[model samples]
Target chain A: MPKVTIDGHEIEVSQGTTIMQATKQLAIEVPYYCWHPGLSVAGNCRMCLVDVEGPPKPQIACYTQVTEGMVVHTQSEKAKKARKGTLEFLLSNHPLDCPVCDQAGECDLQNFYMDHGQYDSRFDEQKHKKKKAQPVGENVMLDQERCVLCSRCVRFCDEITGTGELGIVNRGSHEEITVFPGKEVNNAYSGNVVDICPVGALTDRDFRFKCRVWYLSSQDSVCPGCSQGCNIRIDSNLSRPQHGEGERVMRLKPRENLNVNDYWMCDEGRYNYNFIDRNRIQTASRVKEGVVEEILFEDAVDSLASVLGDAVREQRHGRIGVLVSTQLTNEDLFFVKKFFKTNLGMDAVESRFSFPEGSSDDFLIKADKSPNTAGAQALEVIASGTYQSGEDLIDKTIAGEFDVLISFGVDIDGLLGKEKLDAILEKVTLLAYVGSNHNETSKKAQLVIPSTVYAEKDGTFTNVHGRVQRIWPAFPPLGQARPEWQIICDLSEKTGFSVSADDAESIFSEITQTVSSFQGLSYEKLGKEGSLLSTVKETVEK
Target chain B: MEIPEELKKKWDEAVARYEEKRAALLPVLRLSQDHFGYISAEVEEAVAHYMGTTPVHIREVVTFYELFHTKPVGKNNIQFCHTLACNLNGCEPLIKQLKEKIGIKEGETSSDGKYSFSRAECLGACEMAPMMKINKDIYGPLDKDKLNEIIENL
Candidate 1:
């Protein structure tokens, strides 16, 4: 270990660490471009210039090596002047286009300019002009004028995704980035280039100019897109109404969960927040016949238990099947199984939906697509593990063994198709549903209990690889809708089991002790930065 | 290796700077630009590859900084510093005059490429408002005839 003093702070770092690393270790930030922690070091920008005692001139801390006990000062007059000059030069021809640049508030160039740039410009000359608003890829629109040309995005494509789609073409002033003739930036991780581009040179076509980033607020939560359970932040405007309800979700962005998704989310998850808009069904209620009756909290539980009890004792297995969807949280499934299996003693607990409703691209999305199947099953919830397809589960429900059936599902109807799943739901005596969307499944259910979307509820989920992770709620549940645990807890108390209030931690603890896989785990230790719990089993990327 | 005297002079100057290899860039580029007039593709590639930054990275300083010209400039780079003070005054009308006299638009050189026209931002000479730099020379409070005379001389 080598110890060094940076700006009067003494710190020890491992060998092969640069002076830049030492400053970073001490949290004494030095401005830099062309050096991303995830990418290989390219000490080009000259922005992170630092002063060392032995070395006469300011050295780039990124590439400069740190020796034992060598003094370094990043705040010297010489260093400051050098940095200021560099910034002035960098800003000379740069179009003051921050008003329109998407990276305005978060841009490093803007920040560095304010921090280290000279107040007075040096150039008395006309600015060089370049083409603007060039479409670089399917999802990205590039502005060549705004490009700093750090090549982080290009390098990310080449090295990270192994898809070398973008390159800096031409040379010097005439240089611009473009895709190879026939090749486009149409990779699974292509949207991330927009995120990595330090300037507004690259902007996502989907998110471009919809709303400035400053207006939308973000919440750290897990992605409910797939069983991968990549942690994410839900950016929304709470004051704005949903369908004029005064609160709505605008977009989904990847939160930094290093273990799951390190600041990158698949395009599917990023753009999938559209359905949660006001037009979508968020409130819970059951529709009987042609008349829709919205029942109170206690009544919903009693009605469901009574309905399932009637089906289980007097009726048969196929008639009174329980279809639990993958989008459901562990708490919902826990109480779901408790209400049916413990109280009614029903055997049907299988997922209502599986993965890949569309084409399966070989990337983050998996074929077995439910977000929380493993968690539901880990609780001894009666789930048909082998019966993978949503249509298959619906087919078994329509086989006529039982009369009344219930489903806890969302986004499942599309996979089974409307007519196919509806034909199966039509055979049942009573179809009760707890879902976020009022699609075919919920419509078929004689009683519908409006469920909260993943963003609106706080719950724990078991991803595909059996890693139990907790998801924090970004927004409050929609009006009259409730978390699955609360709904099921109400049902459990009415039906039979000793049920607690809607406290996820208590339920998780109860599950953890009994379930051998999750022996000594607690929500407190499930990695705010991610630690490998023994029971996590295997790391699933997709 | 036989290095040009001018190149060696640049090298010596870059070495004289406190930070040798790092400071070598600006001087080297300026010398190369003097020899080559414009920083051509081959020169940019060699400089970037030698400097360990990509051509794209080096291009930022070359284009953004007023001094470095990625393209060939005329014998004289006619500049009107468009800083706060200059823009406040009637630089627009003055630009119109210069444009007409030069017989080429701002940012364009003559057909022979003897004179290039460009409007620069603040050159840190606020007191000398409406100042312009022709290569390394400074001219301020410029008018139509002064601009024409300067262009004609160039």
Candidate 2:
């Protein structure tokens, strides 16, 4: 380990670590733009200039490697002057569009100007005008004038995704970042460039003009679109009712988790939160004699409990099939296994909701669309006996084997076409559907219970790699919807079993105690990056 | 999409001289430009394929260097020096006279497609202060009459 002193704070670091990284270990701020940890260091931006007690002038901390007993001064007078000169030169050609820029609140240019360079405007000449608001691709909007020539987005496209769609054209002040003529940056990870861009040069078209970032609050969560379980931060405005809309998630930004997604996620997962606010089942409903009616949550639970109790009393519990979705959280899956298998003595609790195979890349995108398929498999929620897979469950339902069925987050019409789903609906006497969205399954169910989405609950999702990560609630559940674990616990209480877990934490504690795979793991132990399951096998396939 | 046999042989020879194929991109680009007169998008793609890189990488290199032309030029390309030494020695007047005679500004070709004119940074010929290159031949150290004679000969 090489010891380096940054601003008089001594710390030992590895040999290859840069001074900028060592300063990070000391919690010292060294302003930088082009040096992203995920991308190769370009070191074009001289904002991180630091003073070193040597023969050379102030060196850029991002490019300078730490040596033994190296002394660095990040906030010295010489370094500050160098940073100030760099900022002045960068702003000489930059447009004064902060008022209209989408990256106003979080722009690095504005931040560094305020922190290091508060000098008066020395540039009285005309500012160079480059192209503005150019639609570079389907997801990205490029403003060439705002670019600081960082090359982070270019390196990302070339190095990370290997798409090689973007490049810096020309030279000097006339230079601009652009894609090849007739070629669009339409890669799967194209949206990540906007996230990595330090300035408003590359803004997300979906999030542009939506809301200023300071007006929105963020909560750490995991993406539910795929089994990669890429960690994310859900940005939402809970007090935006004054803007004529209720609380809603604005966007999903990738939260850095080196083990899972390394500061990047696919555009599919980034934009998948649009369904959270659209077509949601606001209230519980029930159907009687082919007429749908809105019912209270308590009455809906009571009716479902009574019907299940009657089925158990008639010794027809074996015919009662439960179709679970791999989309459900681990806590929800645990409760389902406990209540259905141990308490009700029902042998069939099937997770037969198969997601269509999505396009995957060598990067973070996974073919498995469900985020918790490993959780479902590790907990043994997929029924073992006759109905093994989702296709088998649908086939058995069409064969008139199951008289009653309870489904969670599984779209029946999507699984089987309208014809087969209609045929199965005619044979099933009691159908209970519990989900967050208002899909075809909920429309035809005799009892519909509204469930919370991934953004509205705190639970663990064991990713495809068997890593158990936690997702916190960004906002309250929409309308009368409740967490899936609470719904299961309430239904279990309504029956003969007395399940007393009230919150997600309590149910997770019970899971750690009872589930062998989840033993010795708690919510606190999961932390931000999450911990892998103890019994996770290395050869588990996605 | 087809390279001339001579240029292809030169490109392969240049590639063999370097251990890394990517190091041969500059010479391969120069060979393509020499054979085809200008490096089009298709030429860039061909060079990129030969170099085992992407077209954007080749484009970045081509656009960064003023010597490489991405667009079409006339039969005779004229590159005039615009650095401090040339500007101090009446290069501005020479450029104006050349533009008037050629009937085109910088970065544009003549209407008859006989000549293309561009003002480039120093071509390392500062000792011959007001110098310009006409298709690889440097002519300088004269007035408007000499420039007219050079253009008439071309």
**Complex DockQ per candidate:** 0.04, 0.77
lDDT of 2: 0.88
TM-score of chain A of 1: 0.90
Which residue pairs overlap in candidate 2's backbone? A352-A390
Model 1, range A334-419, lDDT digits (tens) per residue? 77776666666666666645455543455556555567767765665654445555456667666665466666764346665677
lDDT against the true structure, each candidate: 0.72, 0.88
lDDT of 2 by residue, A1-542 (tens): 99999999999999899999998888999999999988888999988999998847999999999999999999889999999999999989999799999999999999999999899998988888999999999999999999999999999998998889999988899889998888899999999999989999999999898888888999999999899999999999776655315538888999999889989889999999877888999899988777999999989999988888888889888888888988889999988888888888887788856667988876788999999999998888877676678767767877888898888888888877788778878888888999999888788888899999999988999998999999999988998999888887888888878876868899999889888889999999999999899987555332
Q: Which of the CAPRI classes, incorrect, acceptable, medium or high, describes model 2?
A: medium
Compute the lDDT for candidate 1.
0.72
Candidate 1 deviation (Cα RMSD): 10.4
> Which residues of candidate 1, in runs, are more than 4 Å off?
A180-183, A240-247, A293-299, A309-319, A352-363, A383-393, A410-412, A530-533, A536-542, B1-154
DockQ of 1: 0.04
Error of 1 at A519 (Å): 2.0
